[model samples]
Target: MTPNAREMSESIHEQMPRLLTELAAVVGTTNVLTKPSQQQSYVQGALEAVTDATVAVVIPHSLVALWRVINICAAFDVIIIAQAANTGLTGAQLRMEIMTGR
Candidate 1:
């Protein structure tokens, strides 16, 4: 990985648990996914060739929840990939690979 990417990955790794906890509080524990299995759909797009790289998948049911999650991620400087329908062909959604949600 590039140096910047590596640094971001390390930072996310260090803050993952806390971030997940805060996200869960905002949208509930059921909406926050930390497992690879649960995060599969969020990371994988329309193309099978695109690798799954997200560390967490957060599902916020409302705009309020979405805003809260964004604020929490921003506070930690974690990159977030906003996804919907998984229709995009480009892998820009998973570029940073830290978090994805809808």
Candidate 2:
């Protein structure tokens, strides 16, 4: 591989473990997963019920873990998409999304 590719790989390798460790610390070992097989049930959407999410899922087992996850996104300024149960009429989750940027 090229130097740039190697550097990128190394960076990802370093950051991924750090983030996973942090997540596992906040949450528990059962909630922190890297295996697709174990997480297969959770990957589905409520609406579709079987629509497999293409992204990683972090299920916070406690309030502290949830807060840490939120803080991490805010601190990093990541553009996040928050979804709620579709049972609501409309616009319920939108308010939370708006306040998240602040």
Considering every candidate listed, which one attains the maximal lDDT? 1
Clashing pairs in 2: none
Q: On a 0 to 1 TM-score scale, where does candidate 1 land against the true structure?
A: 0.76
C-alpha RMSD (angstroms) for model 2: 8.3
Candidate 1 structure quality by residue, lDDT tens digits, 1-102? 445766766767898889889999999999998788887777776556666567688999999999999999999877777877776743665553345322
* Candidate maximizing TM-score: 1
Candidate 2, position 19, lDDT = 64
> Which regions of candidate 1 are displaced past 4 Å?
1-8, 96-102
Error of 1 at 24 (Å): 0.4
Q: Candidate 1 — which pairs collide?
A: none
